[model samples]
Target: MAHVDPSAPLEGKASKETERKLKRESRTQIVSFVFMVFITTTAFLTVASDVIPSGFAIPFILLLASVQVIMQLYYFMHMNAKGTGWVNALIWGGLFVAAMTVAALMLLIGITKY
Candidate 1:
């Protein structure tokens, strides 16, 4: 058996875990980027294609944009990471307020035919 130095930092074990975590995060980011790219291409194609009606394509693209935004916030912004509860709350609260404001405006101004 080999003698171990107690003074040495246990870099092997810690580094391995850190390496695995970084690999996982990198893979996730790549996948998210690819997905976002796909969504953008699809959105562009939808707009470019004459077969797709503007009404449906517009909403579909908006939905995809929202998905991209959510992924960006979670992955790139690291909102889902450690000790970001306040940030998450603030962001979500702002979204809620904005949504409510839009809804109220739509209702009051009769923006929609409904």
Candidate 2:
């Protein structure tokens, strides 16, 4: 039988592989956050610049914000792999319905009866 070395770190101690994995995960979160920010910032800038017609700005901004919210829910909230499937479906469904209602109202209010 071989003797165990007391000077060596225990198996539970952080190994290089574990550290690398953590660093990689951290980078992923950073990247996701940065991309979300970039998308929203650009969307706001476009709306403010009046480069696109006012009719297009609201839809564009809402679409971009929805995408960012989804990304944040999946990446930052750790909901990508966890169960909670019903909660996810329910919330997103509600949001979709609300968005559709708003869009329909906007169309009705802006359109001419003639």
Candidate 3:
């Protein structure tokens, strides 16, 4: 038996299905990256420009941030892939708990005036 070098490059053309899948994945990643960059730019502009009032700008920027986070998780992190139902549920549950905790804290702070 001969030993195979793991570091060596693959020697043959990939199957059609594999090539198609790769192309689709690459396209998705590129689109997601571009969209994230656009979101970042929008957030920067929102903060930099004085035309948009703070009252509106703050929430708008936060909304954009949330969108970016979701996109990052689903696209960059591969959370949208198949067979990740349990992982998805756990992550979403965690996020829900964190959001609730923050809300509760904010309420307490408001009530205590601290």
RMSD per prediction, one decimal? 7.7, 8.6, 3.7
Give the per-residue lDDT digits (tens) of candidate 3, residues 1-114: 299899889799999999999999999999999999999999999999989999999999999999999998999999989999998999999999999999999999999995
Error of model 1, residue 85, in angstroms = 1.9
- lDDT for each candidate structure: 0.92, 0.86, 0.95
What is the Cα-based lDDT of residue 92 in candidate 1? Answer: 99
User: Highest lDDT, which number?
Assistant: 3
Model 2 residue 75 CA deviation (Å) reads 0.7
Instruction: Please write out the lDDT profile of model 2 over residues 36-111, one tens digit for every residue.
Output: 8899898989788957987888898888988988898888876776697987898789988998999998899889
- Whose TM-score is greatest here? 3
**TM-scores of all predicted structures:** 0.73, 0.61, 0.80
For residue 97, give model 1's deviation from the true position in Å.
Answer: 2.0
Rank by TM-score, highest first. 3, 1, 2
RMSD of 3: 3.7
lDDT by residue for model 1 over 4-114, one digit each (tens)?
A: 889987664557888899999999999999999999999899999999999899999999889999999999899989999999999999999999999899898895665
lDDT comparing candidate 1 with the true structure: 0.92
